[model samples]
Target: MSSIANTDEPAAATAQGHGHSASTLTLAVGAVGVVFGDIGTSPLYAFRETFAAHHGAIGITPDAEHIHGVLSLVFWSMMMVVTVKYVLTIMRADNKGEGGSLALLALIRRASDNRRWTAPLILLGVFATALFYGDSMITPAISVLSATEGLQYIVPGFKPWIVPTAVAILFGLFAIQSRGSGKVGKLFGPIMLTYFGMLATLGVMHLSANPAIILETINPINALRFFQADGFTAFIALGSVVLAVTGAEALYADMGHFGRKPIGLSWLTFVFPALMLNYMGQGAMILSASSPAAAAALVKDPFFLMIPDLVRVPVIILALLATIIASQAVISGAFSLTQQAIQLGFIPRMEIRHTSASAAGQIYIPTINWGLMVMVILLVLFFQSSTNLAAAYGIAVTGAMFIDTLLLAAVLFSLWRWPVWKALPLVAAFLIVDVAYFGANLIKVPQGGWVPLLIGFVIFTLLTTWSRGRELMRASMSESALPIEIFAKSAQNSATRVAGTAVFMASTNTGVPSALLHNIKHNKVLHERILILTVAVQDVPYLESIERYSCKDLGNGFYRVTIRCGFLEETDVPALLRTLDLCGAPFDMMHTSFFLSRQTLLASAKPGMAIWREKLFAWMLRNAASAMEFFRLPTNRVVELGSQVEI
Candidate 1:
């Protein structure tokens, strides 16, 4: 019942699993691969758009002061928002060192004392999750497009071929997923390492030309001036610019994989400074240039423009590698989100296969992987340019950020048991920052924000429907299960004598299984002893063996056994039973027959969904991998009884 028992010690206690702690440097490097990939590559297109896009173009002063000021805003925004707000403060709010929107939701849900607001809390989470799907699609499009567009910087004639070539490269990227990313991941760290070195070198070279940019970063006056100049305009530009820091969330989401210390250190020491210097460098480049032709020099390739032409080829290659790494991070995030959704019961269980044997968390969900790949490919093909894809990117990332702030408030007030006086200020500050970004992103809806908004709404509806429908189904099944006390008395007296154990899988510990009801209705008999074994999959991902199962003996030798499994773990009944003490419970193999209940969904003339959705749901149910196979139960011992249900 304790929170620690539910979280920390399950698989390790059972398998003698030992976790190896990564050294500080190794963790920092690895964190770059996992956490900062998306945002790391943002410099490729973020600033270029500012000079060329609507807001930037409207007030295109093309001066060093405003460019310095704009870059100053970016530098400090990363420092204040990404590094300070998230890496320093929010990362510490990790759910057992596992970060992400879900982890934050779970922790807050568990900790909150008030039940009244639970509904809205869950809705907020569902919306955030919905938004992420949009983020997933846009990340690949923008990353690949931006990198591939850089080719034109070197070869102007290649401009006509950029879109088609980018599409082809993305197709190949998605095509190779089944082979897994073990080798690709190995190269990710080294490539990002080179990319960071180039970033630092670019910054150093540009800063030597105009050291005054360093003074702007330190002064904070430029940031104030930039904001005060056109507060409303600056606020609107932030919606898109925030995309540059979207991967800030990954710092926390990936905390479990790389640990908090590494992410914290990387943000403060290497990533933050490199990002600031480069932005400032870009600002300086924009400042000195004259004319759109010369501005073309700065805008054509902001990421590589600071470097000499001799080294541009190598920078271009590194940019490609960084984008690949970024896409991989988003793909991994999609897997983690699906896993959490399954455990939380917002979605049905899917085939979750572990991609890496040694890492418990490195899983691959074929459903999500293929779904994202299709969407990503379509997005790249349609958008053709990073500028177009950028329009659709921010709603989901910022929406999720806003939800995190709300969840954090709940944590402070109820879960952490902080006083109202102390919680109010912290909550207020985050809300102001997060809500501004959320509002800024809202301005983008007509432009391209509608994509994520539509995705979010559709996903929210599905999640709500599934959660409601599952609850109703469970209630109906529970109502149908016979009370164990009455069944035990009758079975022992009147049923046929069986020499072995008869294990009926019950949905509840206090009742006979529905499969047994079907069996008795058809055959007019029940097995001797009638072991009513019930299984409860907990909300959390792991449970201890000692806490794995519990038994209650009904009268006349009918025993009710309940087994617990984490969300990430598959149910293996035989393996679970082997670990049980059984408490002198009789179990002869010849007599033991495992009974399972399989729901056969029926389409009704009565109103629920339209004919199309019913047919779609039916197809989904039929194509779904069998539950028996999913649980890894033995075919011979398992006997399934089908029942009809209308949803």
Candidate 2:
């Protein structure tokens, strides 16, 4: 197996400045829009779901004490999960400047030296990524559905159109993805900013009427009393309480886009305050209602109930736009994650289209986009309501969060090198909360939670199969490969020499590429100058241009070149070759012949993998993007040599 050593040094500081300047404020505003959308929209259904007795779990009483208890739980859950765990702790464990389950996994692996522990950590990371796919699908379905359900409040007669309207909105959102997010992304910050402002305003307006509710909410005693008084019911209520922090991971995952400072500032100064006020406002509204039944009905749609009737229509319109923005963030995240997976060798390459010339991160993946659209649409159709979809929501997120806790423990003791005393308490707190939430969500599996779990499991299988398959394929190829020294010694005397350059793509630096061997054997000639090129994706997000390529000259007109890139970088062989100084001169497309190997995988009774998995891997390999396109080789000058391999 090939492994890249992880660097212990901190990632080079980001070039994007986050100093106390106007640029920093601008980035912070942008961060508010993209980073907090999912959690920001939680007020729509989180409160309502907590009291929903349909699951035979928790019963809601609109008395002051019960209202205070639920509000305290929501407030504390956000503080613990979103603020303490994500904002303060996990975000600090970035890989270079990138944050995500995979990125964190890379960072931890780089820091640890124990080979025995690598497999389990990788499995944890892959499962976390798989769970993210489930979250990506559910976020859009639930966000848009919850936002559109507002139509029922505005016009009771329009209730029947909720599902259809949500479907139309979601379809439209996915349809425009191919064109790219650059154009629409400009408005996300402003729209979300306005949405949060509205949220805080509505909450403050209601909070002013019942000021005592805010005090009760801030006190931790109410939350303790809630668990003590209700016992098992309170524990079940945690399943719904988790909804308030559903999108907390996005804050950390998106840290690479906006630096930690901007994201952290945005969360503390704006997102956190706004979400608290809104949840508090809903609680206050419920407590101040005329009757228990009225409070119950009001909580069903408390987000809209808090808005004044005069501005109800505009608020619903704003809510729909906000949900769309939230959905956009999740969709874009999926694209970014898929690209990372491909670069890290967890999945096969797919066609990646850059939507914006200036932004390297702005990309569109058609397969993921369309696949997500289908799954999201089906989720909407199946659940038929945001409340129903809520049943399926927490499992994927909590599963991922649970995985993150495990990964974080590795980072704490292994990577960060925190002494056991300090790290243990922090890890324990995170684990306790993560496990509590995950265990609570497990109760929902029979109802609808199985959807995300099944999706995660299937995706996890595909990821592992592809990863293992690639490793086995490489081993098989290596077994047959000729050493560069041995090949050069024999070929110099045996083959006829021709003019011009021939570059053969190789998976490893030590072996002769199959394409090179095939060309010399069949064509009976060798280029005067031959280059065996190998591309390596490092664990980091990017490598500096000055440190990109290394070349070694071998006798008999052969040169071995290795190009290194970070996981977030695009690997364009042609582009990197243009900057090459050590390999004769800079490459000229007309003079260069790019030779690629197209492997035809066959499912054999090999010990490497199950026959079914081998077939699945073969199918994925067959459908992957062609090397000529992926490596940006000149189409007319490229030649593909086909070969069969069994694993």
Candidate 3:
């Protein structure tokens, strides 16, 4: 509200395809590759783990009723969660063509100017983001492990080699991230297309053997009957049933990458049909088994068993490739989320490397990539099998989904202004399903569900600490900040005028920068033409070049310039300055000196945060990337003025 402009108009325009030029078919293909990858690979372990005897929750029998019931549950879960809630509903809530918790938070804040609700909404958004880190780490581990576990179906001896093989594959995946995904990204669409086709073909072959399974699965009565018969056990199965829709968040998270229509079309035309057929076919195969013992064995790895013996090796190879693609989606999403966090002031700025020449969203964060690799390898080594990892999976996803329902309620009530009767019933239905899944996963905490929750808590603490600490630090600095008019008059009377132009970076537009005061007090000199510049990150993804900078003349050879950047765009101060012809003088690199303030934070017995948190925030601030690199300032002509601040 100080220097930040309203991003609603620009964000809405971008969401409407203002910047994108891709054809509907092309974007749809891309969506299938990236947006659908996580959910696409769930067939590997969702059904198997649901009835695993080790869990002792849901028991699998060879009877048609049991098989049909599970199939119906999976089918309807996808329809309600993925198709209805996400694809059709949440996708429509895009913030200027962007999705995910943070983007949605910004949209909600902009929609309602209610100061009382702002902080609580921000906390919800931050926690949702924290849970996403858990999802990101678990996704790659489980996806790769499950895909490689297919080796047990081919050679029994390969059982011993699964973990090692997955580790090697994961290391390779993380290693190639620095080079970016542009080259390999093109192959993703075609490879995933082939993978989906194979899924349909295998399912079709099995469905032919027992055509009646499809009819039984299509009916809603089986799901109702299963719940009624199994009671508590069926409720427990909801945790595992949620696996089928594990990557449902990706649909909304990645809406900015591919448009809404493309994602919806891809799901409706190809991905949805392929997944439904395969799941139903697995049910049919188990139901039509020769005996109960045989069916029990097949359910352990139903996805691999669905293929013919002769072609199992080829299919397994295809599955492995598909899983790699799936892992890539979340890894890329992690990088995008971190960038958003930094721009939104929830985290410290980190080094961001643009990987693609044409695509602005394509970026690589070295710290995040290596950190994820280490965590993923540790998980694979610890869990050893996808079955073990499955226990840790659903909690993060369900937690995030539950939070999403809350945010969507805000969107319905405040943003969309939907009628009370219409919104209440729809939101209530979604909350019932979301709460059921979340509660079932909560039961798994004693077993392995604690992993994600623990990770989320740590991350949530770090995020909130940094955010609050920054606010306190800003307040402390603002208390001593001199008004620009007073500082300008003092400088004009007391300081010696130098030969070149000086740009002092200010945190807020209303105050004279600390660096300028320090330079004048110590050096006793100032440049002939002085400028106070403040860089404000807008709540949008990208800003137009013409709307990038606003200049105000403050009199006496002084000007106040505020540069606005979208979260997704690069913040190069010099480049933006050079393009401003209306700022009186053309920017010259050789004649400019940039002044910056480097604050040495002292964590006092402050009331703003706990002592432990203040220390953590201080450590983070010390290790944050330098402003010169982050703002693309020239190193040769820059001067850093150090100051001590207690917060």
Number of backbone collisions per candidate, in order? 3, 0, 1
Writing each residue's lDDT as its tens digit, candidate 1 over 1-647 gives 00001222223334211233869899899887778889888888877665555533363354665676667667766866787678877787866556777767766665554389976997897788888878888888899889998888788799789888887877787777766677678877878877877787787787777788788766668767867886776777777668768777778777777878888888788887887777777777766676756865666557767768988888897888789889988888888888777666667657777677766677777888888888887887777788887777888888888887887777777777799998898888878878887898787777778888888888777666655555545555566666778877776666566556667765456556667778877876665566676566554445557677777877676777777766555565676776676645545454467777777666666455665555555555565555555555577877888877765
Better of 1 and 3 by TM-score: 3
Q: What is the lDDT of residue 418 in candidate 3?
A: 99
Model 1, CA-based lDDT: 0.72
Screening candidate 3 with a backbone cut-off below 3 angstroms (N, C-alpha, C), the clashing residue pairs are: 11-96
lDDT of each: 0.72, 0.87, 0.87
Q: For candidate 2, lDDT tens digit of each residue in 362-465? A: 99999999999999999999999998999999999999999998999888888778999999999899889999999989999988999999999999999999
Please report how far candidate 1 places residue 189 from its true position, in Å: 2.0
Estimate, for each residue in 209-283, the C-alpha lDDT of model 3 and write its tens digit.
Answer: 988888888788999998898888888888888999999999999998888899999999999899989988888
Better of 1 and 2 by lDDT: 2
Model 2 clash pairs are none
Clashes of 3: 1
